[model samples]
Target: MSEKVANTFDGRLIFLMLSILLNVFFNALTVSTNMGSAVWTASAVNLAHLFNLSLGNTLFLEGVIVAIVNLILLGQFDYFRLFRNLIFIVPYSYLLAWFKQLFFAMGIPFLPIGWRFVLDLVGLTGVAVAVSLYQRANVVLHPNDDLPFILRFRFLHGSPCWSQWDSNIPPIAIIVVTAILTHQLFAVNIGTILNFVMQGYIIGWADQHIFPQLHHHLDFKSTLH
Candidate 1:
């Protein structure tokens, strides 16, 4: 189909919904692999442990923090953007829990380390592909995901790799500080390093190949309205 057709309102909604499922499904797969989780999620888990907070609450707080950062990055305040950014997490969290349970029933936890790493690779690639699709759709996004989308188009000269790296710095810092405070680390391993190094490249590749017909339709002004 045409880029215009794929990005129409209905088309965008489809992309948004599919991307959400892929995001949570693969993210849950990654967690079930026990290889490591996304940097942001891992950081949230660490903070949850450090502060004795539930992971869900810690994640919600992190989303709010990122949403505020998004506003600052845009150089304006948009309550709708902030509200939707936070609201997206409510359903997203439930889906994640459900997917995690699905994986548990499938016995992902019992997989061999070699096979688990392989699943982690699939999960990482799936996540990159999903993010690429939804970001181009430019409908709605997790605030954390939106941060990189903003950097990719607005500031990083459309470099997904650089934007991803830039967006990851804060969470990396959080992980470091949490490690210092806790004297231990969790949800970080070879897979984590691979995700950190490779997610942008994978996303960049997906943008070019996965849905070559679909293109970025970034509408920052409209989003503010």
Candidate 2:
């Protein structure tokens, strides 16, 4: 008998693919609320507002920055990797806009303050859970998430606080800085703070319980051999 080992390339790209749609969907839900959005989105959206660009345009540009950072971090430029990042991410930004339009056309409706708060949580949950699922797959990461994921592991290991922070410094810093900028412009609200406070905890929880199982399951011997 032979010991079973995990596959380096698991067949979970499908999960990643699904995560894209889920992410955009939740982004739409959050944005349409007028309550604010995830820190990342708040930053992007505020950037868009500043430059008079659409949120989609802001995301597209941000994705490019993320791709460039990924390349630099890898210490070399790979055409295939660059192509993969652009092909998927450029369109993903537009898809987020599309979903926003779709949801808008469908009418998200005017809700009371309490219900709006609830809606914000729902949107955040969808984004958090979607992020968790694809992160567990541990394959190709989306540019939006890649930087934080990379830095967290590189620097913040073994701290008692790591789990609550999993990807601590980068995201927290991003959220804080962006929160300041967006709030200064009055482009942010409680939704932004809540997501900033909660996302790390949710991702950490998912990493502890969800990631191990998905990794184990996806780690079966490579079927390509």
Candidate 3:
């Protein structure tokens, strides 16, 4: 590759790594507060409970399915994208687990409800910031995040709110089904509600404010070949 392309690649890689850390950390913070989690995360937890599986394993399974769905959304196969999406979840799951443990050890879970609520909002905002960073970077992404990214730019006229709300449908179904089967719900709380309602708008704001110059780098047609 030319020097310019190599530099661009390095820059995106840095963004990808930073975004991954921020995503994991904030997600762990939200869950630690026990206020709720992202809908997809809540669904994964519910499924984990229903099937007696680990959350990490459940997340991996969910990601692989979503990655395949992304291919369908693209209307063609891009093996590299699929592979990268799948690979992303493996480390993501482990890192999330680690961060949650670390946060729990830090007494985040034992905080009073009032403080936890504040942290929950902060955590959600951080998640949105991280998501916007990597999505604009156009490198590898967690399949769940990629789903919304695809919807945002590809089908929703670049409306992050609409795409995020649309992306919630599948996980909402999963959560509902898991509730019916298990007679219980996991991680569906105030934070989950906030995430469902506010996350998209937060992402839109972050796009403009967090890294203003980091424009989206992906081209729809170019990736197909």
lDDT of each: 0.83, 0.65, 0.86
Better candidate number, 2 or 3, judged by lDDT: 3
lDDT of 3: 0.86
Q: Which ten residues in a row have the lowest lDDT in candidate 1?
A: 216-225
- Tens digit of lDDT per residue, candidate 3, span 143-218? 9999999998889998999999999999999999999998898778989998999999998898888767666777
RMSD of each: 2.1, 4.9, 3.2
The collision pairs in model 1 are none
Model 3, residue 187: C-alpha shift (Å)? 1.1
lDDT of 1 by residue, 7-104 (tens): 67777778878888998889878877878888887787789889998666777788888989999999999887787687777766667767877898
User: For model 2, how does the per-residue alpha-carbon lDDT over 1-225 read when each residue is reduced to its tens digit?
Assistant: 111232234346666677778888887788777676876676677677656788788888878887788778767886665675677676579988888788668667366667767777898878877777665554555676655554555455522234334433444465466547656532257877777678767766665765344542222234335
Return whichever of 2 and 3 wins on TM-score.
3
Per-residue lDDT value at 106 in model 3: 96
